[model samples]
Target: MNDYLVKAVAYQNQIRAYAVNSTATVAEAQRRHAAKPTATDALGRSMTAGVILGAMLKGEEKVSVKINGGGPLGTIMVDSNAKGEVRGYVSHPQTEMEINEVGKAVGMNGLLTVSKDVGLMHPFVGQIPLISGEIGEDYTSYLSKSEQTASAVGVDVLVNSDSTVKAAGGFIIQLMPGADEEVLNIIKDRMKVIAPLSSMISEGSTPEQLLEHVLGSENVTVLESMPVRFQCQCSVDRITNAIISLGSEEIQDMIETDGHAEANCHFCNEFYYFDTEHLQALKEVAL
Candidate 1:
């Protein structure tokens, strides 16, 4: 099934929730980056959470998530917009490690930074120390401490034996203002008994069903559903503009030394090559 996310409210709007099925979305990232199992897990989890956070915004707002866990996986970065488009990469995509527990491969040190661009003069940025290198817990911590919202986050990715992604998805549940203690206790109790996130995704659970699994089908009031996917913002034109911005002298240096220039996007791994002739045109434009 194609990936999608669902937004919902339950218990009379006191609880707001977001859930996403990101299997195909993550599989594309794994294929693009040639990520090993551990690296795929880290990247997949971050992208899942990032996309859900993106849905919380409106219009052209965007969100970027950066995680540096002081582990072999290095840094994992994901960008998403309110439209449900998301793209991400891991610094060391080929790193392989054994995972005996939830946060083992991601490590327990470093920070999770979230930056939001809301068409403001400066984007709002929040940084928090990683409580657990597990992507979900780190996001939960960020929301509670940085955003000051009481939230529960669950993100998981299952990797196949051949390093392909089997399933990837997550959910975010937050208590809105005026939420009662009774409602909070019920949600906490339900979460304790819900099936593991990976198992739910592997069973072909939809985003709405995932939320229902945690929030109860009777209580959930589905709000909106939107398709989500792996979408990179990089393009040939953007790369060319970046090269031109280097100035005429730099373009001349490229032409004289290498006779050509090539650029690769870190997010999508797409290559952009400019021959010597193209470089000369860009040099004229720069001048």
Candidate 2:
């Protein structure tokens, strides 16, 4: 199914919820980055949650999530926009480990930082130490510490034997300021019995269905839904402009030495190749 996310409120608007089925989106990232099973799980979960978090913002806002856990995956970076577009990459895409070793594959010794570009002179930056190296709890901790909001975040990814992602998705439920103890207790009780997020997605649950499972069909009122996809804002023109900014001398050196230049986007792994003629043209426009 095409990936999408849903936003809702439950129990008379006492709780705010966001759920997503990001299987195809994560699979795209895995294919672009060539991430192994463990790395795919980590990157997929992060990207899944990141897109939901982006949806929480208003117009023109964007978010960047960085996870550096001191493991083989190194640093994992994901960028998302309020429009439900997201792109991500891991430093060590080939890293793999046992299913039970998810935390070990993404070490718990570093930090998970989130920076938001909310149309301000200065962007908001919040970070928390890796509490579990599991993407879900870490995001839960981030919201608790950074936004001072009580939240439950469950993100997961299931990989097939050949290292392809079979399913990827997650849900985030937050208690609004006026939420009561009764509503809280009800949600807490229901959460304990809900199926795992990845398993639910694997079973063909839509984003709305995921929320229904977590927040109850009777109580959930779907507010909005949007399609989500793997999107990167990198292009040959952008790369060419960057090369031009490096000055004519540098451009001339590239033309004389290599006869061609290649730029790879870290986010989507797209390659931009510039032949000597392209470099010469850029050199003419350089300062």
Name the best candidate (by TM-score).
1
Candidate 2 lDDT, tens digit per residue, 1-287?
88999999998989999999999999999999888888899899999999999999889999999999898889989999999999999999998875546778789999999999999999999999999888888999999899899888989899888878899999899999978857766776887898887888899889889888877899999999999999999987788889999999998898888998989899999988999888888899995
Global fold similarity of model 1 (TM-score): 0.97
Q: Write the per-residue lDDT of candidate 1 for residues 73-153, one digit (tens) a residue.
A: 888999999999999999999888765243766777888999999999999999999888988989999999999998989
The C-alpha local distance difference test score for the whole of candidate 1 amounts to 0.92
Residue 80, candidate 2: Cα error in Å is 0.2
- Spell out the clash pairs found in candidate 1: none
- Per-residue lDDT value at 133 in model 2: 89
C-alpha TM-score for every candidate: 0.97, 0.96
RMSD of each: 1.2, 1.3
